[model samples]
Target: MEGFLIRAVVVGIGLWLASQIVPGVEFRSTESLIAAALLLGIVNAFVRPVLIILTLPIALVTLGFFLLVINGLMIELVAWFLKGFVVAGFWPAFFAAIVVGLTSWVMSGWIGGPPKGRIDVVTMRQTGPGRWE
Candidate 1:
């Protein structure tokens, strides 16, 4: 679908920015960047949830801050799965994951395919009466 491809491209750009901002996060070329994006998505979909569940106690204890470690581990896992992408060590992967998350957040704000300035909310009251209240 077009939406999926657009999200992939956004994620790829996030990965590219991560490589630029974080040392030891390296990609060989655009091809590798695309590959990394795919792998990252797959890894996030399949592995991240499991890891999050397993680390729930730590995450809860840290007020969800430990999600950053899980994110870094997912980045490292993607690098391990892909040949042309390399993450030198844990610290680099941690910082790279932070950059990737931040980039994706900013890009999503700009590129989200929603009607401009529209807000969707659910209310208990019906449309006509008491709607404003």
Candidate 2:
């Protein structure tokens, strides 16, 4: 769908930004960068949920801070399967995750714009004195 492609592109931009901002995150080639972005989307869609469920207790005890670790793990997972997408260590992945998440959030708002064909409004008419229809 169109939404999915837009999200993927946003993620790609985020990954690119991460590589630039995070010292230890690197992509050897553009193709690898693109692939890593798409793969990260896929991993987040599928693997992340399961991991969240499995780590619920730890995540709760940590007051959701462990979600950051989960995000870093996802980045590391992508790096493991992806050639030329190098994450130097857990710290690098953690920082990269933060960068990518922030980039995606900002870009999504700019690129996505307002929602299409939808509006939030309320209207009311007086029927009988203070009684509304």
Each model's lDDT comes to 0.87, 0.90
Q: Once superposed on the true structure, which residue ranges of model 2 sit more than 4 Å away at CA?
A: 113-133
Tell me how far the alpha carbon of residue 44 in candidate 1 is from the true structure, in angstroms, after superposition: 0.7
- Give the runs in model 1 whose Cα sits over 4 Å from its true position: 113-133
Which predicted model would earn the best TM-score?
A: 2
Clashing pairs in 1: none
lDDT of 2 by residue, 1-133 (tens): 6776777788888889988988999999999998998899899999999999999999999999999999999999999999889999999999988988888878867777436786868998889978996
| C-alpha TM-score for every candidate | 0.82, 0.82
Report the Cα RMSD per candidate. 4.9, 3.1
Model 2 scores a C-alpha lDDT of: 0.90
What C-alpha lDDT, on a 0 to 100 scale, does residue 63 get in candidate 2?
A: 100
lDDT of 2 at 124: 85
